[model samples]
Target: MKWKKGLTGMLLAAFLCGAPGVGIATPAHASAGEYKFDFGGGTVETGYTGVSASLSYDSARGYGFRTPENMRNVSASVRFLATGTKSENTFDVDLPPGLYEVSVTLGDTSRSSIAAEGVYQVINMTGNGAKDRFQIPVTDGQLNLLVTEGKEGAVFTLSALEIRQLSSNPVTNRTIYIGGDSTVCNYYPLDSSVQAGWGQLLPEFVNTNTFQIRNMASGGQIARGFHQDGQLEAIVQYIKPGDYFILQLGINDTNPKHNESEAEFKDWMRDMIRQVKAKGATVILSTPQGRATDFNANNVHNAENRWYRSAILALAQEEQTPLVDLNVLSSAYFTSIGKNATLALYMNGDTLHPNYGGARELARLVAQDLKRQGLSGF
Candidate 1:
């Protein structure tokens, strides 16, 4: 996905939060002019307005296809709108100037690249029961969305589109950006997935109205390699003043394959810290939690393979940044729960990663630490 600047300084992005579950339901506090479109000229899903491909843009309707002739309705049993040509996939909706949570349901079989307001909203999301919901700022009084093919031979398909205004706007809202490894990244099929990261569940514990949680952490990431691979660049583009950057890494840095020395790890972290700080964003350094299998025979959880913890602590003091000692917090929790029960927290008894329950508990600890440190978001 690419980022583009709107006249209102709104940042364009389609950060995936979760996949399709029970379909779109009406918000309890629905805003005026909220929209729900069930595309493809078939039986409209409950609570959704039916939209056919032949329906062109009409002033009375307030929303429609820009080029109706180029679109096709392939729905027979289930509603589906498909377009093989990129130029023909344009759709528009008239929305008041504000931030809106756009929920789009894509077809299960084919992949698609969705862009709104000249910025990619959903990028290359394809799978069974695929869906994406993200907040986007609308400044031009209209939400212009384009759905194009994701890859070769993949026609763009749309099942539904729902738009609801949000109280949070891009200009005023502060975001909590998280950067780290698999232990802090989001996993797919959130409802069913056993694996999860603390970053993924952090949103549940924080105030979303004040801060948006953008978890950029991914699996198999290290201190130096994460920046080298251009992951930080994505965060750097959107991070601005009043935003908080929470960094928790070092788990993968110890791997011999990464070859990241202690000094090099600190150097890379310092680089990331300075970069975000330069953007007027506050940096919060955190020690990655200890592994589930890091306990000794005496039933005590030891901070093994966490050599970078000391460096992180030192840098937190040296840089005068807030620190969340997840290593200490998580270790104490595991020890309190006993060895057998602690092992149950991890998926398949894996030491390095945590299951959903474990991730939620870890996230709770992180949230508590943030509150203890008096961080603004908490």
Candidate 2:
């Protein structure tokens, strides 16, 4: 194993807790500034509009809101010097599900302030009002920031505020590292709309708060191909000890025109497994889902090319890695659904890759095996 280092080197945390919907209350305040809140239930950057605070930074200012053309200033970097003493002050921030470094700097350079995210679910910021920073995990993306105003309605001078994704693992929550090919890539989706990769659907079955499903898989990538594309390196960079790494790549490798002999394929998998294991992460290897098979034996992916899947299974045993036999389970599933139904689950009968339904089935099989093995984060 070359033990690909520096693979990790990107931002990496937290939970999803709250009612079915976040209750955003922008109560009446006597402040002269403006504010924008985004409760991210969907793509739109909109939320409740309460009494305005007019302190929005002017774009002409160099270090202010990097608001995209017509979008709201969700990425604003302004100082709120007057968020009054309302008994309860709460607002939801629309942040993407990922690890972030959140900070709140008070006005005075030598004073104390208690700034927090996740409604006291996370840690508190304590320091000289310069810049108090902390790592925060955002599971559902609609992050809640709670502030309890003083009895006299004092001025809470927020000299600075920062929220950005981390470039390293804070090790806040469990992570499922998905490593695979097109069948598992988080693609943009096709015309009919349901045909997406299985990895994209995996999140639905698992709990986002408990586990972060990091899809590092891509299209046209085998074990060797993934490494060549910097994916393997990226995986190594963030996969901490106790995290789970799912390896599912074989369909692309099985192509006759593709590079690598059977032994080379096996060796590549072995090395990847070894490397992942060294990082203190548990590994799960999955065989690719079976392509569309005609009962009359006329499919291009005939019996001869089936070795790629078996190689994955055999290597799993060789590496003592858990196996999610999608080939067997997916084949049985599509068969139960029948040829027409199976074709419907693909992109207009593109047997090679699965459509949305097919991807869901593949995800179900993996989820079953993962939960079966008692994986921690599912």
- Write one digit per residue (lDDT tens) for candidate 2, span 265-290: 88888888999899989999988776
lDDT tens per residue, model 1, 273-326: 999899999999989888778788888897944848999998999888999988
lDDT of each: 0.70, 0.54
Angstrom error of the Cα, residue 154, model 1: value is 11
Model 2, which residues run further than 4 Å from truth?
1-169, 189-193, 294-307
- TM-score of each model, in listed order: 0.70, 0.56
- Per-residue error (Å), model 1, residue 342: 0.9
The CA lDDT at 95 in model 2 is 52
Best by lDDT: 1
